[model samples]
Target chain A: MSTIPAELRFAESHEWARQEGDLIVVGISDHAQEALGDVVFVELPEVGKVFAAAGDQAGVVESVKAASDIYSPVAGEVVEVNEALADGPEALNEAPYDSWIFKVKPANAADLGKLLDAAGYKALIGE
Target chain B: MGQRTPLFDLHLALGAKLVDFGGWDMPLHYGSQVEEHHQVRRDCGIFDVSHMHVLDVSGSQAKPWLQHLLANDVGRLQQTGQALYSAMLDTHGGIVDDMIVYQTDEGYRLVVNAATGDKDLAWMNANLAGYDVRIKHRSELAMLAIQGPNARQKIGELVNQERTALIHTLRPFEGQQEGEWFIARTGYTGEDGLEIILPATEACAFFNDMVGAGISPIGLGARDTLRLEAGMNLYGQEIDEQVSPLTSNMAWTVAWMPEDRTFIGRAALEAERVRGITSKLVGLVLEERGVLRAHQVVRIAEVGEGEITSGSFSPTLSKSIALARVPMATADRAEVEIRGKWYPVRVVRPAFVRHGKALI
Candidate 1:
């Protein structure tokens, strides 16, 4: 079974957003990594890049099977990214929750409430 | 929904991530695809290739019927248990399917792709009016490819003493029936190994025995990478109905001897030979960080454009490589467009690794 941290919020697209004080840490869910298979390459957006909403494309993740676009979880600026992922894309596969892709400084931190909770996310994945 | 192979139960029990492959449920990986790729290169690994279609052709006119049906001459397989790699073509020179035909005592056995089974059989049935031959699709058979340097030695210890003694005497690209099993020292990976074909009922038990003997059970995820690293062609990707054998690095397989052998697609191939071959398949090596992939546009300066057919990251070489069909006038250097960005690649022969040694 995929791990769903109760404190974090999730998107239907398999991304999770954990609220940390003011900034929100965003990454793909465990279900997402297992479905993508072995990751061979990763392409992340430049720091300071701005996104209009959670739908914005922030980066790309390519597994041995196929490539998928990583979307932003909230409307914000990309304050920080997991720069270490360039050389070690397998980290995302090892632990998707621990390997946060980027931290977004949302225009309104309350937008995090729009995302689904752990129970809802689990139900969405038919857990 | 898809059909399951004989080893389906074993695969699910081993924690393999199953995927739909040509209407069949097959393992993509047990866990780590990169580690599986390394296992085959360094030691040995077993692949459940039971999804591949096997056809048995036997009759009085089997030899002559195959000579006319295939692009490669079946006349070359004179000795018993010898195998031949040939492409069955349509009248217009399009590739119907690429297959391996083995000359057995009964007649010839053809192992074809699972996706193209129906069309290939239909094509065979349509052309069998004049020739007397019985082609039976052996769906009851399951196949496994035990590949790598130590594959033979490990597999040898599993069978009976009679079969064990025969393994050392077998030659490359050759297989002989031992009771009910057909073992051939041939593989898609550029490594020393054997492809064993046996009845479906006995496959699971034998597979469990091999795995118990410490033979790593590899999945299809690594199979694609291993074949790509070895510069081998995949049926649907590299060789298709739209692509001819001339440009697909299969010219050597076609027979032009005696000037009287009337193989299907010969006239068009001869015509193409007279006109000239414009596109050629070559290997591309990317020394950079980017991974090369299929459908990616290759920018060849002045000589026009091309696209990669098979591409992946080589675990042995520690770099990305690909096989692309480029204009005959193209040179040694080109740039590939990956995710809207262009990267440089070096051109080499369509082979990278052989027997655990790096070629490029």
Candidate 2:
């Protein structure tokens, strides 16, 4: 079973959202990383990009197997992006929960509540 | 659930990630695909390839029948246990399937791809009009490939004295039968290795013994990357019924000499040669960060456009590489469009690595 931290909220597409003050930090969940095998490259969203709604295209995560699109879990504007992933994409596989892909300034903070909590996400993945 | 190999239970015990591949439930990876690829390149690794079909062809007219059936000349096999790689072409010079044929004491043995087995058999049977030949599908057998630099030394320590002697004496591209098992020095991975064909009932025990002796169990995921790095062609990706061998970097496999030998598709191939081949397969190296995938558009400046046949991140080269079909006029530079962005790539020979060494 993949790690599902209780503090994080997740989208059905497998992106995780964690609240930190006014900004929401985002990364792919452990389940997503595990399913993707070895990550070879990551195309992080540019800072200042805007996603008007939840589940919008944020970036791309490519594994050795195939490439997958990363979606934003909540409506947000990208305040900061993970530039380190450009050189060391394997960190996403080694430490997915700690490796945030981007930091988002939510357009609506209440959108986090609409996402699945730890238990709900676990159930959704059939864990 | 798809068809399972004789080593299916053993694969499960090794914590393999199972996936459906050409109607068979094969292991995609034991753990990390990249790690398994590195293992095969650096050390010894084993693979269960029993999903592939093995057929024995024997008859008084076996040699003549095979000469007509394959594009490569079986007459090239000077000695028993010698193997030859050939393409089985259709009437239009298009590839039906690529296979390895070995000269045995009785007659010959062929190993074909799993998904193309039924079609190859049908084609083979239909073409045997006046031949006194018999085709037997040895589905009761299992195949395993032990590959890498240390493969021979590792395998030599496990089997009996007679098998060990045969393993050491077997030349490259040769195979010999030891009782019920047929051991060959040919492998899909470019590494020096052995491909062993044994009875299905004895597969699990040998696989377990190999694992117990510290040989890693590799999966199809690594197998694809290994073969891609070696620049070998994949059947559905590089060559198909619609694609001719002349354009798929497989022109060498087609035997055109002995001009009167008139094999299947010979006339069409000759016509294609006279018409001047337009497109040819070449390799692409992406120095950029992102991976190159199949079906990506390849723009060759003023030459023309083409498509990537097989593309992936090569663990050996530590970069993304691909085999693309481009116009014959294409030079040493091209651009591949990945995710709407055109990334410049260097064009070279199809092979990127061989024997754990980078070629490009």
Task: Say which candidate scores most in lDDT.
Answer: 2
Model 1, span A39-118: residue lDDT tens: 87778888899998778898888887778998987899989999888889889999898999999999888989999999
Q: Share of real interface contacts recovered by each model?
A: 0.35, 0.95
lDDT of 2 by residue, B246-332 (tens): 999889988888888789988889999999998999999999898999999999988999999999999998899999999999888
- How far residue B160's Cα lies from its native spot in candidate 2, in Å, is 0.5
Report, for all candidates in order, the number of backbone clashes: 0, 0
Question: Which residue pairs does candidate 2 place in steric collision?
Answer: none
Off by over 4 Å in 1: none
Alpha carbon lDDT at B321, candidate 1: 89
Candidate 2 ranges beyond 4 A from true positions? none
